[model samples]
Target chain A: MKGRILEVARRIFGQYGFHGTTTRMIAQEVGIDISTLYYHWGEKGDLYEAVVLDIYEDLREQLFEVEKRIHGLPLDKRMEIAVEMMTDYLFERPEISNLTLFRYFAKTRHASPLDFRVPEIMGNIAHSMGLVSDKKQLPPDAKMKMLAVMNAIHNFVSGQNFFLTMLDMDEKEYVKGVKETLKFLIIPAFVHNGATTKRA
Target chain B: MKGRILEVARRIFGQYGFHGTTTRMIAQEVGIDISTLYYHWGEKGDLYEAVVLDIYEDLREQLFEVEKRIHGLPLDKRMEIAVEMMTDYLFERPEISNLTLFRYFAKTRHASPLDFRVPEIMGNIAHSMGLVSDKKQLPPDAKMKMLAVMNAIHNFVSGQNFFLTMLDMDEKEYVKGVKETLKFLIIPAFVHNGATTKRA
Candidate 1:
C-alpha cells in the first residue's frame, strides 16, 4: 500500500501539480484511507517532496551508470552515449520531465532543494564526457552551451507526443530524426568548439 | 470591458491552463461580475479559443514584419534576426510560450485549428530566410531541423525564470547568453549544412 500510494502520487502530482493535488485525491486514487497515506508519508508536503526526490534520484543513477559505461571513450562517442541514454530515459518516463518543469514553475519563489544537486549532477556528467575538466569551475559560455543542449534534449523528449502529432509523423521515424538532429547540434556546439575540444 | 476581459483571460488561462481555471475566477480577477464575463465572452471555451487565436495572430504579424525587415539578407543573417526577434517576443510575453505548451498537452487528441496555419507561417518565414525556395514543399530533414531549432528557442525563453534562478545569474546576462548559444547552434545546423545552403 505504501509503494502503491507513491506510484499514484507521482502520476497525480505530475499531472495536476502541487497546489492542484490534495491528500484526499491521492488517497482515493491509491484505494486507501487518508490516515494510511499520512501514516506512510506524514503530510502532503512530505509526499510531494518524496515523489520529486525519487524521480531525481532515479535519473541521477541512470546518468551515473551511463557515465561508468562510457568512461574511456572519445569525447564525441561519450556525448553520443550520454544523449542516447538520456533521450531513451526521458522518453520512457516523460512524467519526470513534466514533473521537473512543474517544480520549476511552482517553486520559483522559493529555493528548490534539488537546485544545488542538479547542477552538481549535470556538472559531473559533463566532466565524464570531457566537456569539463576536474579542479576548475565551469565557465559561463560552456555552461550556456551545455544548458542549451540539455534544454534541447529535455524539450524534445517531453514534447514528443505533441510534435509527433503536430508533424503527423510515425513514432519510430520521429525518434530517429531526433537522434540525428541531436548529433548534428551537440557535436558542433560542444565537441568541435576550440575551448572544449576532445581531451587526449 | 470586453477587451479587459480578454486581456485578463489571457493571463489567467496562460498561468492555470484551460481546465485549471474557471470563468468565475477570471471574473473575480478582472473585478467584474460573472454576468459581465458571460456578456463579453459566451463561454469558457469561447474565451479560451479567442485567447489562442489572438496570440497566434499577433505572432504571425510579428513574423511577417521580421520577414520584411530582413529581406535580402544572407541566410545566416536572416536567421539571426528571426531568432533574436522571436527570443525577445517570447521572453517579454512568456504567457504565449506557456499557452503553446498547454495547448499541446491539453488538445493532443485532436487537430489544432492552428495546425495548417502554423506550418504555412513557419514555412513562409523559412522561405524568407532562404531555407526553402519559392514554390517548393519543405523537405523532411529541413523541417525536422527547423522544428528542433524552434523547440530549442521556445523552451529557452519559456524556461527563463526557472533557469535564471537555477543558475543564479542576472536576467540581462542570461538573455544575452541565450542569443549567443542560439547563434552557435542555429548557424551550423541550418546554414552550414549542405541541403539548406544559401541561395545564389
Candidate 2:
C-alpha cells in the first residue's frame, strides 16, 4: 500500500509538479482517504521530498550502471552507450525528465533543500566522457559542456510532446531520431577534442 | 497601464506559467485591481493568449533578422551567427524559454489551443541551415535535427538557473559557455553531413 502510493505520487508529481499537485489528488488516484495518505506519508511536503529523493537515487544508480558498463571504453563508444542508455531510461519514464526539468526551472515557494545532485552526477558524467581527471575538481568548462549535453537530452525527452508533433513520427521513430541526433552531435565534438581519441 | 500589464503578464506567465499564475497576483504586482486587469485583458485566458501571440511575433521578427544576416554566408559562419543571436535573444528574456518549456510539459487543464508556432519556425530554421530546400515540406530528419538544436538552446537558457549554480559562474560566463558549447557540438554534424563544405 505504501509503495503504491509512492509510485502514484511519482507519476502525479512528475506530470503536475509540486505547485500543480496535491495530497488530495494523490489520495483520490490511490483510492485512499486523506487520512490514510496522512497516516502513511505525514504531509504533502514529506511526500514531495520522498518523490525527489526517490528520483535522485534512481538516477544515481543508473549513472553508476552506465559508468560501469562504459568502463575502459573509448570516448566515442562511452558517449554512444551513455547517451543511448540514459535517453532510453528517461524516455521510458519521461516523468523523470519532466520532474527533473521542473525542478531545474521552477522556483516554487516550497523549494526543497534537495536537488537532483547535479554536481555529483555531472562529475560522474565528466569522468565517463574523459573530460576530467578527477571528479571532485571538475573544471568550470567541463561542467558547462556537460550542462550543454545534459540539457539537450533532458529537453529532447521532456519536450517530446512538442517535438513529436513537429516531426509527425511515431514514438519509436522519434526515440531513434533523438538517439541518432545526440550521438551525431556529441560524439565528434568530445572525441575530436580529446587527445585520447577513439582508437577503437 | 495596459502595456505595463502585458509586460508584467509576460514575465509572470513565463515564471509561473498559465496554470501557476493568477490574475490576483498579476494585479497585485501591477498595482491594479483584478477588475482593471479584466477590463484591459478580459479573462485570464484572453490575457494568456495575448502573451503567447506577443512572444510568437517577437520570435518571428528575430528569426527574420537572423535569416537576413546569415544569407549567402558559408555554413559554419551562418551557424555561428544564428546560435549566438538566438541564444542571446532567449537569454535576455528567459521567460520565453520558461513559458515555452512549461507549455511543453505542463499538461495544464486550461491548455490554450495555441502553440509556440513550432513547425513554422522549424521550417524557417531548416531553410536557413540548408537542411531543406523548401520550407513548406520539411523532411522528418530535418525537423528532428532542427529540434535538437533549438531544444539545446532553449534548455541552456531555461535551465540556466540550475546550471549557473552548478558551474559556480556568473551569468555572462554561463552564456558564453553555452554558445561555445553549442557551436562546438552542432557545426561539425551539419557541415560535415552536407556536400556544401566550408570553403570560407
Candidate 3:
C-alpha cells in the first residue's frame, strides 16, 4: 500500500506539479482515502519528499554502478561510460528526472527546501574532477565551467521540453545532439583545462 | 488598463500556474470586473497566450542581439556569447523565466499544442550547427544532446534557488560551471568525434 501510494503520487506530481497536486487527489487517483495517505506519509509535501527520495536513491545506485564499471578505463572511454550512464539513467526515468531538475531550479525561490542528496552528488563529481586534474590553483573560472556543464547535462536528459523546442530536434536527432554536444562543448573547456594530462 | 490587466494576469498565472490561476482572480487582482479582461484579451486562454507571447518576444529579442554580436566570432567565442546572453536574459526576467520554464515541463494528460518561440530558437541554433558541421547524417540523439546543453544553460543562468542549494554554487560559481560544463562535457564529444566536420 505504501509503495502503491508513492507510485500514484509520482504520477500525480509529474502531471499536476507540486502546488497543482494535492493529497486528496493522489488518494483518489490511487483509489485510497486521504487518511490512508496521511497514515503512510504524514503530509502531501512529505509524500513528495518520499517520492523524490526514492527516485534519487535509484539514480544514485545507477551512477555508482556506472562508476564501478568505468574503473581502470582510459580517460575518454571513462568519460563515454559516464555520459552513457548519465544519459541512460535520466532517459529511463524522465519524469523523475524532470522533477529533480525542476526542483533544483525552483530552489532559488526558497519555495521548498532542496533535496539533501544534491550537494553530495555534486561534491562527488567535483572530487572526481579534482582527482583527474592535477593542476594546482585551478582557476575560479574552471569550477564555474564544470558546474555549468553538469547542469546542462542534467537538464537535457531530464525531459525538459525547453531544449527540444530550442533545437527543433526530432527524438533521434536529439540523442545525437547530446553526443555531439558532449564532444564539442564539454571537451575543450574541461578535458584539457580540467585534466592532469592534455593529450588531445 | 490593458497593460495593468496583463501584469495581474502574469502575477496570478506565475503564482498559481495555468490550471490553478483563473481569469476571475486576475480581474480581482487588478481591481476590475472579470469582463474587463475579456475586453482586453478576448478570452482566458488568449490572455494566457498573450503573457507567454510577451515573454517569447522579449527573450527572442535579447538572444537575437547576442547572435548578431557574435556572428563573426569562432565557435568558442560564439559559445561565450551564448553563455553571457543566456545568463543575462534569465536573470533580468526571473519571474517570467521561472513561469515559462515551469510551463515548459508541465504535463497535460492530453497532447497539447505548444506555443512560444522556443522551437524557432532551437531550430535556428540547430541550423547554425548544421551549417558549421558538414555531417550529412545528424542523428536524433545528437540533437537532443544539444537541447540538453541549451536547457542547462537556461536553467543555470536563471539562478533558481534549488540549483544554488543542490550545487552549492553561487552566481560566480554557477557561471563558471556553465563555462566549464560547456568545455568539459560538451566540447569533447563534438570535437574529438569530428562529427562537426564530417561530410554527408
Stretches of candidate 2 off by over 4 Å are A195-200, B194-200
Tens digit of lDDT per residue, candidate 3, span B85-132? Answer: 666666656656656656667664344455665555555554344323
Global lDDT scores for all candidate models: 0.73, 0.81, 0.61
lDDT string for model 2 (A1-90, tens) is 899999999999888877778788899999999899999989788888898888877887888888889888877788999999989988
* Whole-structure CA lDDT of model 1: 0.73
Best model per lDDT: 2
* Candidate 2 per-residue C-alpha lDDT over B102-123 given as tens digits, one digit per residue, 9 for 90 to 100: 8778766555687557778877
Quote the RMSD, in angstroms, for model 1: 3.5
TM-score of each: 0.86, 0.93, 0.77
Q: What order do you get sorting by DockQ, best first?
A: 2, 3, 1
- The DockQ of each candidate is 0.38, 0.65, 0.41
Question: For residues A57-172, could you state the per-residue lDDT of candidate 3 as single tens digits?
Answer: 77667756766777677665666666666776676667666666556544321244534665455444443433334333334344455456555566666554555655566676
Per residue, candidate 1 scores C-alpha lDDT tens digits across A62-118 of 877877878888877888888888888888877677777665443322333553367
In candidate 3, stretches whose alpha carbon ends up further than 4 angstroms from where it belongs are: A107-115, A127-150, A160-180, A197-200, B7-16, B19-39, B42-44, B109-112, B116-119, B126-146, B165-200
Chain A TM-scores, candidates in order? 0.84, 0.91, 0.76
